[model samples]
Target: MSIQDIVFVTGNANKLKEVKMILSSESSKFNLINEPLDLEEIQDVDLKSIAMAKCKQASEILGPNRPVFVEDTALVFDEFNGLPGAYIKWFVKSMGLAKIVQMLDSFDNKDAKAITTIVYADGKGEFHVFQGITEGTIVSSRGPTTFGWDSIFQPKESTNGQTYAEMAKEDKNLISQRGRAFAQLKTFLAAESM
Candidate 1:
């Protein structure tokens, strides 16, 4: 089935927009839908499990006819031993990015990576999970054009010492965790359709 043939489920408008843009660039014939799922917070310790919980919730809400997709992502720092792995949202809400960077400053290790796990369910209890990862380091200062942790998080081996946020949207999309996951999803969808 083409993207146009599938109904995309999402509660976040920003994420929905980004996903739609990525899908459209790959195939204009695909359809994008923004259906919010009644998802609940999971008390799980692993990001993958949390993502599956969200997907299961969405699948239940969507019934048996529609397929729902849910994604959970985390930022793991080498020094912190993955302190914020599955609690990234909590960390963001409690300490914010600047404080997190300040806390990281005390450590000599700045190596980090962003991992995203995407769960897709067809409302029949059957699901698929896809993971995408991007390795990088945390920078000390913020950049002019980046948002969120974009200004402070620099990907490893990046040219000009730029963060994901500093790169153009197209460029970032090519290397981002979401990008990698979506690429895999596209391939899956294509194969399934055939």
Candidate 2:
């Protein structure tokens, strides 16, 4: 196949769907594809560093001089002092969202933020990073969606007052951290294509 306009390296179907939706809404001639590539993530507190490292590693492994992008996300809780932060995956695996909300129940402050960083490396290895952050608080897990940390997150800026898991997919795309990041990416790609 011809080189895709961009290839997003990720395993999460939810993310892929959100990004595709964002890109398609542009009505621009840009192609985006996702192929899950597991890479050893460098331990870091910075989401940008991790995303850049993954993008670099993925491009190196793929080795065809194509535009490749990868993203990393962190859910930061003020009560835990951002304890999990970039290490959220392991934290989620061990404690799950229920435990996180439960642990926060005793605290007076429940302020939290969700961050997503996307690093894109061109065939020449030049990288550009886009980030999105949503300020929210932890809520009791609700909804049927299984994506990590969604059910427990209640974004403060949303007018619907629903957790990410509870909103329709398009609604989530409008306000999600990943959605915002991809929105920026879409703009960047459009400008670059000109």
Candidate 3:
């Protein structure tokens, strides 16, 4: 597992940048390079399952002799009982941030968590899933800096009550779900290398 580079099946440059940044900040001897595969998202309430599908597909397409990784994110709402849990991406695309906030107007319990599942698959076809969850509450979209549902999600770890979108990018890195998951992935990679 002393990999110098990995095939990350993603087309999103932002994701690639974040992963690259995370790895660069660490002392580990691994670099995440993009493969740019448009893997289909499978239906599952479990984020891990979705990630596993992506990983498996990426591994299969790239052959089973190489190391690759894929990530899936899900936004779970407490009051909605996770109605739009795994479909948060679709919701964001179809309904936009305003509708998401407005949907919770009547619900007092606005508690929510952003869950990021990062699945690493080597040539062995074994899936290693690292998850990161950040507790936060739904708030009105306040900033135009971040993308997706970030503007309406105020992470509990935020000191200034700013939503993830409102906080500085580097600051969000300290507490964001994707940040934490990749951090765990870093530790896992290091441990496996040993």
Candidate 4:
């Protein structure tokens, strides 16, 4: 199948890298164009809404004729009842990853949820959202402390009990929230293109 060009609007380098890695494949239908834009995100409890808003902004800036997608990620703590859902970027920015993990030190339940929402605009005022969630627990920083909160969140299904940072890139992507969301996007794009 011929690859189709699609704009991926994101300014975060780390995020962009992961998206590229996760979506790259021989059978991949999309040729993701990295178009970094300073799109303003809306403060909302719904993850899909925020992603849709960002996609809309990107579609507007890139032109309504161009197909585009935008992603929003969230780290939600069960103890805090999702205190930093969409505001996780700020939480990590202000408190740092270590301190954020320490916040759950007092609580017995260290459960948390990692979420990724990918919003797509068909360049005709139509919007589609694909979301993925990984259920996990918060632990002390346990691996290479490079990416945001990667060292602290451990997926419950992981047999080795390794954090995202501890796992190989391919292994992590196999179960990552972003990877799952992108999988949905890939499937949708494949069917839509056909």
RMSD to the true structure for each prediction, in A, is 2.3, 2.1, 1.8, 1.4
Backbone-clash count (model 3): 0
lDDT of 4: 0.88
Q: lDDT tens digits, residues 138-186, model 3? A: 8988888247788899999999899987888788888999999999988
- List runs of model 3 lying over 4 Å from the truth: 1-3
- Each candidate structure's TM-score, on Cα atoms with residue i matched to residue i, is 0.88, 0.92, 0.93, 0.95
Q: What ranges in model 4 sit over 4 Å off? A: 26-28
State the lDDT at 144 in candidate 3.
84
Model 2: weakest 10-residue lDDT segment is 1-10
Error (Å) of candidate 4 at residue 1 is 6.7
Per-residue lDDT of candidate 1, residues 1-194 (tens digit): 33444556666676777788677755654555677766786876577888888877777676756766887778888887876777876776787777888878778888988887888875456799999999999876556522446666787746777887678778877888888888888788767656
Candidate 4 to native Cα RMSD, angstroms:
1.4
Local accuracy of candidate 2 as per-residue lDDT tens digits, 1-194:
23256788989887787678877866455577777998889988778888888988888888848888998989988877765788877877898878878878789998899999999887775889999999998888888647888888899987878899888878888888988888898888767766
What lDDT does the true structure give each of the candidates? 0.75, 0.83, 0.84, 0.88
- The full ranking of all candidates by TM-score, starting with the best, is 4, 3, 2, 1
The worst-scoring run of ten residues by lDDT in candidate 3 lies at 24-33
